[model samples]
Target: MNILLYTWLGSYTDDDIERHIRGMGINCRRIEDTQVCNGDRYHNDEFCRSFEKILEDADYDCVFTTNFLPLIARVCYKKDIPYIAWSYDSPPNLASLEEMDHPTNHIFFFSKDDVEDYRSQGLDTVWHMPLAVDTDKWDAIKTAGRDIDVSLVGRLYSSTLPVLMSRMSAEQQQFFKTLTDLQLKTYDRNILKEFITDGIAQEICRTYEADEDATLRPTRKQLLYSASTYVSHLDRLLLLRVLSKKFDTHLYSTDTEADYKSMLPNVKFHGPVSYEKGMPEVFKSSKVNLCPIFRENVSGIPLRILDVCGCGSFVLSSFCPEVAEYFREGKEAVMYRSAEEAFEKVEYYLKHGDERESIARGGYERVKADFSYDDRIRRMLTQAGVLKK
Candidate 1:
């Protein structure tokens, strides 16, 4: 099979998707087709001409890409080529779909609910094809001392946390004993305060330290409690703080290693790592992959979940109903109700490698079978009518 993957090459990592397709003995070429800056009036004259030449000469069987790019969709339409439109976000309403003039055959989405949602909105051709991970890249990593118990990957979304915390008023907290009861382990609020302090200190050190008289920026915790509700970095900070009290925690981002270490001397902080090169080591070294999100619904399962699972490492993630669609709790991956529960699960799995390995293997098998990149691309091609059944 010959395929052309129309995508943003440098955006995140699509190597897995490409590898998976090639692994199935399908020849694939990635062509960058569109740019977002074009906005509503899509125009990429150079790219369109180049893409047209590729499509005209290659005799490829399938063209898979995001439908959101209208210019590319227009090119595909002109060539009478069947194209698969991939959508990762929530499906648009009927009105929105009607506005999109391209007539794509296959619409690939992340969850079945999204498929149903699009169908309800009258999209007859939508298909459920979840995001995938590169099993080859995200494998077990090894570390020296088991220095940290919990660690998180991904950019911090700090604004959402305070809104959740402030709204949990005394009355609300008292009324919903469910959240409290779910706290299987107790967490020290002081640890959270420490996280807030460290975040502020780091910010000051990085940008404001040159001015000796500069006032300290309000800590994330203080901002959450204040009248102005949202601080985008608060969610990760809050989750980190709560987790820190329960176990030795680390924050490993692409940057901020030196600053974070200076702020929180005890907590392990490693700076930015090259995704392709550094991820494998992190997965093997860390005991538990902490996947936490403050938002619901729109908080779609991240690509890292599959990566961590593929690596044969245990994951302790925030509860999301959509997760049940891919992994079975207690069988494939662990889900936690609160920080304390998250801590306990991490500790439990760390000691019981056999059980942890069992769940890890289950997760890896599930991802390899259902969420492999090759499987997804093929499904899209088949549904798009680009490849005959």
Candidate 2:
């Protein structure tokens, strides 16, 4: 079967997906649909004209992308071609969620919570799928020895809470902090919505209106989004502060929302590393890689954790129930509930080299067997009805 792959700015996932589709003996045609990708998310006349022509002329079996796009789904729905999207983003994009119910679209979410949520709303197109890694690439990466003790490779996000706090009554600020603390402690799911009532949301909305600066207006959803991001930032900071005091902790990222450089005095802050060249080495070379999952994520396995395991490296990550489905705790991976557990595990695992190596090897084997890019592509295709079972 011939497939058309639509993509935008280079995601780390697209190339691997295309390669694997071809490996399955399927003709995968890629179109960089950056025109519509850059334009209106709902409708783009120029791209609609261009995309229609291509699909009609090529008569491709299905259209695929690394992440779900509403624009693509709408076009495919009209043209009568299947559109498949494998989401890597935890909750996927909020805008994309609305278009998921289109009959022609098969939208796969890495997060089970997303599928359950949309499905609860009776979205038939939603399906649960986990993120995958190109194991072959990671397995080949050679690192001399494990030197880095503890590390986190993603951002220390900036939160609007700080700015919002300036305007809120002291009680409101405390309420906001309480929400973050409660969300952080409730590891199984993101319960931000439960506590964020309409009254509270209205209060926040009114506060933004009173802002002296014209640029301070943010919608209720935006405020909630910020709250989620802030809590995640706090979660990462909590662990980083505690762990860095004891272990040789390092954070490698392109940028930061907070002043992690100054804030994390004990932790070393190396600027960004390319995913292809430097990331795998960091994974394999570290005695323990820290994956403080984004607070918004529910049961989806973050690609970072899988990538760490793909490198045959040990990981100490924030708690997520789905991780246990594929990996044996204390054998293939380590999951921690609180900041204390995370700190304690790092202390224990650092000194135990043999156990760490064994777990790493097991993790690599597990991902290679179940979560390889090839397997994920094949599964996605079969489920999307692109490939014959």
Candidate 3:
């Protein structure tokens, strides 16, 4: 099959996806169009015209992207070409779903909830495909002995919170505090929306100087999502802070120095690491890799867990429903429901080396057997009707 891998520059997943497609022995050509990629007006006439011209010139049987592109979907619909989009993020931008029902669009989402939601709306083309790991790259890294007791590699979401919170009054601050506590304690459901009414969200938006345009105003769902992310940031920081007090903890991220110095002074913070060179080594060397699911992703499993497992590292992840679906709970991987439980498990695993190594081996075997990039891409292509059994 001849495939055009449509991508945006600077996207972290595009390189991996392109590599996987070519590995499947398909003739793949990649085209990066910044205008259609980074632009805000994806549904505008100019974008459609530019994208249509590009699609017409590229001679390929199918077009595939890491995420949904509405303009591309529209052009493919008109040209009668299949457009396969595999989305990695959850709660996809509402605009992406507008052209979802187009005949030529085959959309895949990582979250089961998202797939069910679209299916309920009568879109049969949408499928739930969980994210997989590039075991080929990950397994090549030599397992140099475990150096760090526990490690986490990702964003802290510290950049936006202070600015947003600075505008609120004491009452609003207290209200948000209570809501975050509820979000931290609760699981599966987005409790922030149940507690934060539309009026309260508008008031908070006003304080933040949100634009007066109705389109720009934050909806209750958006506010709840923000609150949930804020809670996740705080929860992660708290977990690291307390875990550091008892055992060595390392944080690999681009978090600002001031935030770490003030909040988690004892925890070691390293600069961000790329997936190709640095992450596999970190995972291989860490005794425990922490996978704290963002609160906004109620049941979706983060890619970090899969990557860690693929590297043959012990992972203690925050509870997610999908985790149970993929791996056995205490045997292949460990799941923690709360911060206290996470810390307790970390201590137990650190002391019992045999048990930890056994679980890590189990996770690695499971991922290699069932969740490799090659397997995932083949299934995706088959679903898109680009590959035959």
Q: Which candidate is the best by TM-score?
A: 2
Candidate with more favorable, higher TM-score: 1 or 2: 2
Q: Which ten residues in a row have the lowest lDDT in candidate 3?
A: 210-219
**Rank list by lDDT:** 2, 3, 1
Compared with the true structure, what per-residue lDDT tens digits does model 1 show for residues 310-359? 77777777765567657899888888756567767877887887887788
Root-mean-square deviation of Cα positions for candidate 2 versus the true structure, in angstroms: 2.1
Q: Please give the lDDT score for candidate 2.
A: 0.83
The TM-score of predicted model 2 comes to: 0.94
What lDDT tens digits, residue by residue, belong to model 3 across residues 29-134?
A: 8988765666763567887787678777867788888778877888888888889988877766655457778888888888887787689878987888888887
Which model scores highest in lDDT?
Answer: 2
The parts of candidate 2 lying over 4 Å away from their true place are 207-220, 256-258
Using TM-score, rank the candidates from best to worst.
2, 3, 1
Give all TM-scores, in the order shown.
Answer: 0.70, 0.94, 0.90
Candidate 3: segments with Cα more than 4 A from true spot: 159-175, 193-216
Supply every candidate's count of residue pairs whose N, Cα or C atoms clash at under 3 angstroms.
12, 0, 0
Model 1 regions more than 4 Å off: 33-50, 87-101, 139-147, 158-232, 254-266, 294-300, 351-353
Model 2: ten consecutive residues of lowest lDDT: 212-221
Model 2: lDDT of residue 137: 79
Q: Estimate every model's Cα lDDT from 0 to 1.
A: 0.60, 0.83, 0.81
